[model samples]
Target: MIGNIFLFIFATGALILLNKFLAAWLPKRNPKEKYLSKAETLVFIIFLLIIAVTIESYDVNSSVSVFTIGIMVPRQGKTHRTLIQRLSYPIHEFVLPVYFGYMGFRFSITALTKRYYIGLVIIVILALAGKLIGVICACMYLKIPKKYWLFLPTILSVKGHVGVLLLDANYSKKKWWTTTIHDMMLASLVVTTLVSGVLASFLLKAREKDFAPQKTCLESHDTHEELRVLSCVYGVRHARGTISLISALSGCHGASKPFAALLMHLVPLPKKRKSSELLYHELGDDVHGDDEFGTNDGLEINDSIDSFAKDSKLLIQQVKLVTKMLNMHVEICNATEDLRISIVFLPFHKHQRIDGKTTNDGEIFRQMNRNVLRHAPCSVGIFVDRNITGFQQPHGFDSVQHVAALFFGGPDDREALALCRWLANNTLIHLTIIHFVSEDSQTESPVRNTTTQDNNDVFIEVAGRDQTEHEADRSFLEEFHNRFVTTGQVGFMEKRVSDGPHTLTILREIGEMYSLFVVGKSRGDSPMTVRMKDWEECPELGTVGDFLASSLDVNASVLVVQRQRHSHDNFLDD
Candidate 1:
C-alpha cells in the first residue's frame, strides 16, 4: 500500500520550497531560532512519515530515503544551508534516540548463548587490532608527531551513525548477515565506541591547558619593538570604525616604529548548526573566487581595510570567523597568543542613536566582551562609539582628530598613554594628557621606586604602598611631554580635584572639547576618584569609562583599556 510516484515528488519539492522561503525572509542571525519548537517537531516528523510511506521502491529503510533527499537538495549558500540545518535538527534530537532504541530492542539477548559471547569478544579484539595497525601505517607515511598516534587511532576508530544505518539496511536485504553475526557486529560497535572515549580522556588530559587571565599589555612591551594588534568587530559598520582606529595607530609607517594588525570580523553561527567555525586567510573568496560563500558579508569590510593598508604601507591580515558566542573568547585568546599580539581592540556591544545616546543593548555580545576582557592573552580595549567610523582621517591641518588620554596611575593607565603615543605619531592628531591629582598632595621630586623585571619588562611602584604611583606617573608623562609637547601636536595639563565629584566636574568641563577620550578600565584608587562608582552601570569600564560611556552631555567616544591579566588560568577573577 503506497502512494503514486508523483505524490512523492510533490512532497519532497514542497519541503525544499519551504526551506528556501523561510531562509530568504529571515535575517543572517537566524530570527527563526524558535520556529521548530516541540510542537513543530511532531509536525515535521509526521511529514517525514508521509514522505517515507510514499516511496515503495526504497522500502529497506526510511532514513535512507531521507538521506537520498538530503543529497539531492542543493546547499550552495552558507546562509541557505543554515536554514536547512535548523529545520532538520528536530529529527536529530527527538527521533534519533527513538530510532536507535527501536533497533536495539529488535536484537534479542536471549538468542545469544555463552559461545556467542566468546566469539563477539574475539571479533571485537580482532577489529581493534586491525584498526590500530592501519592507523600506524598511515601515521608513518604522513610523518605525524609520535605523541598523537595513540589518540589519533582512538578518534578514527569511532564509527559514524551512517554505518549503523547501512548495517540495518544490509541485514534487511538478507545478503550476508545472519542473526548471530548481525548482533555481534552491533555489540562490537558499542564496545569500540566506549573504548575510544576512555582512551581519549586519559591521553588528552595533559594537553588541555586552562585559560589563565593574562597581563600581556603594551605597557610591558618594549617601545621600540614592532607593535602587533588584533582588531575585532561584530559587523561591517563596526569594521569601518576599527579600520579608522588602526589607521590612527599606523602613523606615517616610519621604519623607527613599525606596526602590524589583523582585522577579524565575527559572524554568529545559527543555533543547532554543526558547521565548524572556519578562519580563512582572505574573506568572501576562496581560491576559486566567487564560491558558494556568496560575498554577502565582509567583502566590503575587507576591501576598505585592504585599500587603507596599501596606502599606509602596512600589511593587515583580514579574516572572518563563523562561531557561537560561547567559544569566541577562546578563539580570540588563542589567536592573540599565536600572533604574539600586544593588544586587542573590541567594540562596545551597543548601538548609538543620533542623539548620542546608546540603545539596542546586545546582552549576549556584552557577555562576549566580558569573557574576552577576563581571559584575553593580551591587553584588551573596548571602544565606545560616537560616530567613530565618521572620524575623518588626518588629511591636513584643518581636518584633525582631537584625542585626549586621562591618566591617574596604574598599569592600565600607562597602557592608555602608550596607545595615545601611537595615535599622536600622526601629525593630524592633537594629543592631550589630562592628569588628575589630589588637592592636598604637592608635586615633589621623583622618588626612586623603579622595579626592574626580567627580559626587558618593568613594573613601576610609587614610594607609598597605599597611594597611587606618583613617581612612575611623572616618569611616563615626562617622556611623552618632552617628545610631543614641544612639537605643538601634544598638550599636557593637570587638574587638582578634591574628590570624585570634583573629578567629574573637570571631565564635564573638558569633555566637550575632545572628539575621543582614552581611559583605563582600572587605575589606582586615589582620593580623587576612589568614590566614583565604577561598578554602577558597567563594571568592565572601570570608573572613568563608565561615566564617559553613559554621559549624554559629551558627544565624544571612549576607549577603555585594560592590561592583560597575569597568568592564572586555573583561578579566574569573578
Candidate 2:
C-alpha cells in the first residue's frame, strides 16, 4: 500500500509538471497566437480527461489531477484568457447542473431526521463563526476600512460549487459513509450560498447611499489652484499614451500651478452576480500592495489586475512614475459614478494591430465612453492614441511641446481652447489655435455687417440669422484672442476652406507637425463637415477628429473634447 501511494504521488507530480510545460511552451512557440484554436483546445481537454480517467483506474482520486490541470492553464494575455474563458463557459454551464443532479440522486430525501437537522445547524453555525472571525481579524490587522468589515466576512463565508465537488469526491472514495451525512452537507452548502448572497445584496444597496458628491465644473475656488483631472485607463497598452497626455495637461514642464489626477483604472465586472465583491477585493489588495507609489519604468511588470488580458500593475506603475516625476498627486480607484471629478478622460478602444487592421474586444468600451459622456458632471475628453507611447522631448529637455487646438466655432471647441489655455501657462509648451471658417462665411457682404443697429430702429429686418450667429462667434473669438493669445504667449491662425476635402488636406498637413491635436465633437452642421461625413468611423470623434484618428500614418495623438450639455447654452447665446 505504501509503494502504491508513492507511485500515485509521483504520477500526479509528473502530470502537473507536464501541464505547466505545455501551458507555457505552446504560447511562447506561437507568440502571435491570441488563443489556442478550437481543435487545439479540444485535444488538450481530451488529454486531461484521459489522465483523470487513468488516475481513477489506479484507485486514486481523479479530482486532484483534474483540478491541477485546470489550474495549470496559463492565461497569457487578455485576448488569450478571454477566448479560453468564453469557449469553456458553455461546457461548464451545461455540465455543472447535470453533475449536481447526479450527485443529488445518490442521496435519499427520506434520510432527513430531527437529529441530523440539529447536526447540520451546528455545522453551519461553526462554519459561519469561524469564517467571520478570521476575516474580521485580518481586516483589522490590515487596517481596512470599517465599512467593509461585515460585508467581507459574510461574502467570504459562501462556498457552493467547491464544497459540492469536495463532498462528491469524498462520497466516491468512502462509499460506507451514511446517507444522512451527505444530505446534511448538501443542505449546509445551499443555506450558506443563499445567506451569503442575500447579505451581500443588502450591503451593496446600503452602501449606495454613501456615495461621493458630484463635481459640476473644473474651475477651482482659487483661480491660481491646480486643475483636477480624472483619467480612466482601460488596460496597460493604452496606459503609456494616457499618462503622456495627462503629463502634458498637468503642465509638468516648469508650471506654477500643476494638475492633480485621479487615476481611475477601469475593471469590467464579471457576468456572475456576486463577482463585484471579488473585483473590489482584488483592487483593494492592489492598492495595498508594496510600492503602491513606487516608480516602475518597464511596461512589462507582473502586476495582474483581476484576470484581464495584461498586467495592469506595469501600467499603474508607469503612471505612478510619470505622476510622481511631475510632482502631481495621483490617487487610484475603480471607476464609479460617485467620483467628484471634472473632465473625465477615456482612451479610445480600437487600436491598430500588427496586421494594420483596427480591432478591439467590441462595443463594450464604446458603451462605457457613451455612458460617461452622458452622465459626467463636467467636460469629457476621449483620447485616440495612434502608437504614441509616452512623449519624447524632441530637442533635449528644454524643447517646447507642440500642442494645437482646432477650433470650429462651437461650445466643444471653446472647451478645448479652455484646456489649451491651462496648458499654455507652461513656458516650455507652445500652443497653436487654428480657427477654421468656411470660405462663404468669411467673404460675406460687408453691407450686412454694418446695418445691424443695437439702438431702437423702427424698421427692423429679421433676416440674416446666420450672419448674427457669425458675428457672435467672431466677438467671442476676438475677446479670447485679446485675453489669451495676443500677448505673444501663443500662436493663432485662421484658415478658410471651401469644402470638406480642402479642410481635411490642410488638417492632415499641419497635424503632422504637432505632437498632439485637440478638437471639439460638435462641429455644427457646416458644409465642410457634411462633405466629410462618409469617412467618419467613430462619430463620437467629430468630423475633423475622426478623420485624424482613422489615418494609419498620422503620428499625432488626438484629444476629442465635448463640453457638458448645460454649459453649451451659456457659451452660445441665441
What range of 10 consecutive residues in model 2 has the weakest lDDT sum? 324-333
lDDT of each: 0.69, 0.62
Tens-place lDDT per residue, model 1, 1-574, is 2555556666677875654553334423443242233444344446667677656455545566577655654333333333354656766787778878987987877777888898888877887788788888999997765677777888777755775776576346566678877777787778877887777777668554422223356765555567888999876667767777887787754535767888887776556743335655543343432223324445556456545654666667766666788888878877877777888899888867766557856888889999988888678999887774235455567878888899777778888988887887787788887766566664452322233323321222222324345556667767776677656678766566677888888788777898889998885556777678843588888888988888766678788999877443532442
| Over 4 Å off, model 2 | 1-223, 272-339, 353-357, 389-399, 442-472, 566-574
Top candidate when judged by lDDT against the true structure: 1
State the TM-score for model 1. 0.55
Please count the clashing residue pairs in each candidate, in the order shown: 6, 1
294-363 per-residue lDDT for model 2 (tens digits): 2231112222321212321112211232232111111221222334455778888777565556777577
Count residue pairs with overlapping backbones in model 1.
6
Screening candidate 2 with a backbone cut-off below 3 angstroms (N, C-alpha, C), the clashing residue pairs are 78-309
- Candidate 1 regions exceeding 4 Å error are 1-215, 253-256, 274-295, 388-390, 443-468, 486-489, 568-574
